[model samples]
Target: MQTSVIISTYNSPLWLQKVLWGYFAQDRHDFELVIADDGSSDETREMLAAMAPNSPVPIAHVWQPDEGFQKCRILNKAIAVAQGERILLTDGDCVPRRDFVEVHTRLAQPDRFLTGGYFKLPPNVSKALTQDDIAGQQAFNAFWLMRHGLPFTSKLLKVVATSPFDEWLNRLSPARPTWNGHSASCLRSQAIQINGFNEDMQYGGLDVEFGLRLRHVGIEPRHIRYSAIALHLHHGHGYVTQGMKERSHGVKENTRHNRLTWAERGLSQWLDSSNRATLLRDDRLTRF
Candidate 1:
């Protein structure tokens, strides 16, 4: 099935460029790239315009006005426009491995969503990475990362290890495999059934809320943290605030108590004819 890789981004054009380069190097070429921009400056739009023409796969930009940390809103907008049956959601700062898309495609199930993990890089390593490193696939190498000042840790082994041991560990880990926005995939129809993410949420725990809603609707989360890996670029969480946390917590609590299967303010709001006409008139929404 065709996949739509939805990447969320703000103002980090440099990191986004590196992430796109990683997508350009994907071993699987059947997926399309969709940027669910959370109101970035002109720099990001210009960068996308310049790169869209030469991209290996189709590129689309779905953006909204800069309202502080409205990721859920923009993501719903992207989902409204995505054309693929399977939707892979990630961040623009997370660089996927060559086999990332291939693994997700191979493991996709009708009654489930895939939850993956990321090997977080230090700020130094993230700053040092270049498009050439991503294109050559050296950015995913454990030795290469170590040489670039990554501290030696067991988690770093994810970069190079693809053994059955790793798979076993993924399955055995106590951490509940929730749908991480940094690296996750689900059927587009399934996402639609849940009516997309809760727009009431902010930065913290928004992904967890979406995952919980999916489960409320009977879509199991399959753990693929070992196989479908991505490298998360280091960045400050300046957008996260106590107010945002409280709001997100409130939403999660409501979902837990109510067992909410659908978001009240979600993709359907944006998919309506009025919003579509407005988006069509807006120069910001570009499809390639």
Candidate 2:
């Protein structure tokens, strides 16, 4: 089966390189790397272009001006041009294990979505990190977890079946399939036949909404987070920074609905980059 991996990037140049290189190490025979950059001013474009020529598989770039957090726009477009029947989606900040694709493919079925796992890190570390660094920060992480009071595990992320009516939702229940949006995921045609992601959602709800859409259409997600591990390069805080590293204005709250619109004059600055929903097919490229 042909697989297309879609990685969406903002201004995270250093992290993006590690993520792309991880793709090169995969054992899969057929796949493509689709970089949908959110207008990073760093050496991202140059680095991606340089790597494209020597790549064993195809690499394509889709870029637009910073447009807040419009991941759905890029993802939907990338899926349109993807050569693979199965679409693998992850972030520029995460690096997949060599067996990432293998695990997902093994678990994938026609009517189920696959949500893989990710290992959270601290600020700026790569997959090549030494075990000592991981051990040294164990204490720091423990304090951080207690202080934040956010739900997390040693592996950093966990998945759950969010279906309200499912038997799994009860107090005593057997483990059911799970769904979360951006670690590692594989969805078939049935999952997206209606629409991929609801572009209207701004912050965290979009992925969840899409998962709900899948369930609504009879596509239950297979809870496979811990099984297919990926490394999520760390951030200073638990949250990944969104806007201009200086201004810190892209973050939105329900009261501030204006932050959701990128069309405004000053608001566009908050958005690193964006593009209209479009599909660029291989037919547009000239042959040698």
Highest-scoring model, lDDT: 1
Assess candidate 2 and give its lDDT: 0.56
Estimate TM-scores for all models: 0.95, 0.66
Model 2 lDDT per residue over 1-288, tens place? 467777887778777877766666666758787776655664878777766765667887776566666666666656555557788888887766665677677767877788655656654234344333332333124344444443455334222222332223333334444455455465535434545654544445445555555566677777665556566777543233543322222222221333222212221222223412343342121101
- Misplaced by over 4 Å in model 2 are 124-178, 236-288
lDDT of 1 by residue, 44-145 (tens): 989988988878899999888886888998888888888898999999999998899999999899998999899999999999999889889899888899
10 residues in a row with least lDDT, candidate 2: 261-270
| CA error at residue 191 for candidate 2, angstroms | 4.9
Q: Name the TM-score of candidate 1.
A: 0.95
Top-scoring candidate (TM-score): 1
Clashing pairs in 1: none
